[model samples]
Target: MSSSSPSLARAPHHDGSVTYLGPVPTRPGGSVRLRVHVPAPGASRVRVRWGQDGEPRLRDLTPTPAFDGQWWTGELPLVNARTSYRFLIEGPDGARHRWLTAEGVSEREVSDRSDFVLDASDAAPDWVADQVAYQIFPDRFARSAAAADRELPDWAVPQAWDEPVVAAGGPVARQLYGGDLDGIAEHLDHLVDLGVTTLYLTPVFEGRSNHRYDAVSFDRVDPVLGGDDAYRRLIDAAHARGLRVLGDLTTNHTGSGHEWFRAAAADPTGVEAGFYLFDDQGYHCWLGHPSLPTLDYRGRELRERMYGRADSVVARWVDAGLDGWRIDVANMTGRQGGVDLTREVARGVREAMTRVNADTWLLAEHFFDASADLVGDGWHGVMDYAGASMPLWWWLAAPGARPHATVPLPIDPLPARDVVATMREVHARYPWAAVTASTVHLDSHDTARFRTLAGGGEHGGVDDGSSDSGLARARHLLGAGLQLTLPGVPALFAGDELGLTATTGEHARTPIPWDARETWDAATLDAYRELVALRREHPALRRGGLRWLSAGVDHLTFVREHPAGRVLVHAVRPRPDGAAPRDGEVRLPAAVLGGDAADAVTLRGEGLVRLDDGDEPVLALPGSVGAHLWLLPGDDLAWT
Candidate 1:
């Protein structure tokens, strides 16, 4: 069948009032209860087909209607802690000849692969779903007014507070403007005002460079960034203001200046010799980079010192008031030339962290598919760039004035269908638990700033859309509105709301404009504030299952439904040159939004958005370059 196949039949969809989405675990070895609504009145037979995790064979079971006679319930004997199932509603009053499954009533048979999965063990920290995180680059976020940061390492090139870190520089990563933890603590009020409850600081450990992927030690914070005492004070202050701080760790390799590596290199027969893979040629570094050497997790001593032991790095920081960690280059860690111990290492780290704080969230910096690492055993989730952010950026953000704008990944704008299909395909591969816990980000320290590319910060050409500040802000706001309605912790990079400009990754790491913030656009900041508050106000927006209503070439309309309620988000690009704007009305299926009659939904928005929840609900939108949101009452909690 086509990807654009009609999800529902022309006749009234046989949507039962009963929900198929919820917690499915019923304890070990206990039967899993499942139900589906037989919305078609007088429907008699409803059969359930299910299979164990990834199993091809599905056992069939029959269900009987309850006293209300609207839903059919069944129980499947537990096979494992995780499995999937689908409903086959037959003997309906009318319409489809085949049956109904999780994807809705269909004339064509739907693949059982799309069946709803139940994993009792799939759980992450509850606080993860409710968080709105701010990503901060330690060396560029802020600097103290009194602190003189001019005295820097010989390898680094120091710059003024307001200067941009040009991509074509003498030493890119090593350049430091000296933003410290104490500075972050000083600006706690800024974060609280922006409604950022979670703070993600890129590595702050002792290292040769500013980026700090190359850690020189495991036990101490960098003295350049105010050292151990400064870190402790910063965490305490952040916590006092109700902010959770997350640290960054690199398990893949160690800096050349690290004590372990220097000692191992001096004597091959030393105790730490076995900790790394050393050949006759030289050291076994990460990707042939001599400055960084990969650790061999096969060594019991290395594993114990890094994560497995109670006093190890993972356990120490998590217990020391840190909320969690973001593992750097996690895909390459614990794997070298067929030696794969990624799971073992991650599980060890997770166990160590769990000993201190069970709520500790462990995420990974994976540039590719990481479903294998997120299978309910290791990391809670990843940065999620590959799954959603990168592709969405390619489609939504304007291609800016960067030299090599055409990287391997698609930079050309993709149609709305392609965007929707890509997200769905990536999401289907992961368990829903991992999906919601992942960091849904637009851009980070490793990528070009989104505002520079999309918000018109990089004025490439007149038609580029950055020249018109109002148009650019509105377009950027649409993206923010759509992202806030998505599941996962809404991750916002620092200075993004300030309309910062940067054409490349190095440039994106430019310092926050604390000294000259008065020049920033107030409208853009208000848009961001409102979007963050909107997500905070609704539980459905934070952790809802996406149900796409329509995907046009220039527009995306979807409903996010949680037990609490449904949030309708619709976004459309501006009208093309000499072309008329789209019709200001969109009709959605009544059942998808939890209402069968018009006026069932009560809308609250910043602009015009009218809702009529009839059998086929219609939303009257007013502008081409605008996003309209509406909410309908649901059986779930009013708010989490």
Candidate 2:
């Protein structure tokens, strides 16, 4: 079986086709084997190139007699923090059609012109772990009623809030809700009060719609949302308030109206042809969506212009004091069987970011299994949607939904044991130091609002609809408490803290009703504040290993063990009906319930409570509809 045979089973490819080749415990100046799978036969020549910027280095592979169809491996000498490179399958007559490039090039194009390989030593910046991110949808956040309402820009038409979010043809909802960067700057104090350390803005680059995901120009900020100066001012204002801001970067595709796309569409072989996937019939769009045309990263000039070179769009933004970038659709970057473009892009981004700010964070928006993509020294971390968050939602909100639930009616809450076990497995698989920076949230712009999922009200309905406010608040508190106390970072969507319930998509993205603060349910906010304060006060809750104490269908309790000198016992209950009071003593692990050796414990009616013993404290088990976070003191003890 030659390497080109498609039937041959190949080893699973790493995150983005890049491989880690070195001693298990890597040391500086060591040597390792770099292996890649090429499924082609009759390959006479294989060429490899390795070097850093402004340097030429080379190597060639001799064919192994009767080579198996499996992976074809190569050896390379390792040097600390050096940008090395390699390419296999050189001649056009060879059967092999695939090879890995340090520059994320397509198989057809492999030359010295490609960008430099990423240095594996680069990791995600430090600030990412300690930061709290707040996502802002520009249009829906806040409107400056005082400022003149600008006319609808090109490719955008104004419509009422109730209108559908269709494309250019339909009655599109494009009303200028007036929320701009200046408005965001004006409300920095409010963000500070909410304890946000980072502001993750939706794409502010030049675009037509409210959501700027369909970018027209990566270099320019949208004039409707404020221009480059406005962005800089916003960044400055946020910095003044001790906040960091990261702009969204959409690299997978661009708007059809983008200059590059327009040029490519006009002439198939134009200068911009390499920038897009153009054929006789215009440029290739994503999923046939005319508005978004995919970019062809195979072109050396395109990669260098967009991601390479000091003056590249990515580098330019970082140089402008932008904290970092949130890469959109990261998993979709690489071409099939070619170098993982995302890894290459991430490398360029990392280099550029480190050059600008060593503490800059690189957050990728990947909505799939990200363990491989996030690890392997490619990115700091992706938006963690799998490990901690999805499970919680499945257990709490859509329990009756498939895979987890077995019966109809109200499904049983996710077992506390299962939650802890899943958390443990995820932690074991992805250590906190390596892949812990995650944006844990109930909902974002992509999904239905948390309140609506919690059965607060019907979609497209008025506020008169009733909600399980008290029950929902309790659940929200429990979720928020766990989120804050968990190992990874936590993110709270705007208006979620104030218990803003939305029945429709537009409602979910509506501006924060500051006036409603006095009238809206503040229980969620209060609980979040308390949890945040608790997390801040206790080192254990901030950074600690979690241990499950007791868990059942109705009640769940766990403890956070900190290395410093603190422990926190947290508990939550779902049953609305109170637990029957047990007259006999309830024995608990001394680490959890830190009181005199009581053989039996008494339970009151339905409510949550926390008991402090010496410095250590225990959160008493809540009977129904409540959550408790108790601060504990003294050395951590093992719990069974």
lDDT of 1 by residue, 1-640 (tens): 0111134212112211123444545344666555554433435465666675546443444444322234555566556766666656555656455555434455577775455555556367878888999999888888865347435667677777766576656778777788988888899898999988999999889899888888889899988788888899989999999999999999999998888898898988997887788988887888788888999999898998998788999999887889999899898899989899998888888888888998888888887778667654688788887777865775576644231242465356667768876776666556677777788886778777666556565531111223555555655666677667777788888877777656677777878778676766676678778888888987778876666667666667776765677677777765424244343344443444445324344443434333555454443443356667777666631221
Question: Roughly what TM-score does model 2 have, to 2 decimal places?
Answer: 0.71
Q: Taking the tens digit of each residue's C-alpha lDDT, what string does model 2 give over 89-108?
A: 54437444445443222457
lDDT of each: 0.69, 0.57
- Backbone atom clashes (below 3 Å) for every candidate: 3, 11
In angstroms, the error of model 1 at 258 is 1.5
Model 2 spans with C-alpha error above 4 angstroms: 1-122, 145-149, 157-175, 279-284, 335-339, 398-413, 459-467, 503-507, 548-550, 576-587, 591-624, 634-640
Using TM-score as the measure, the top candidate is 1
Range of the 10 consecutive residues with the lowest summed lDDT in candidate 1: 9-18
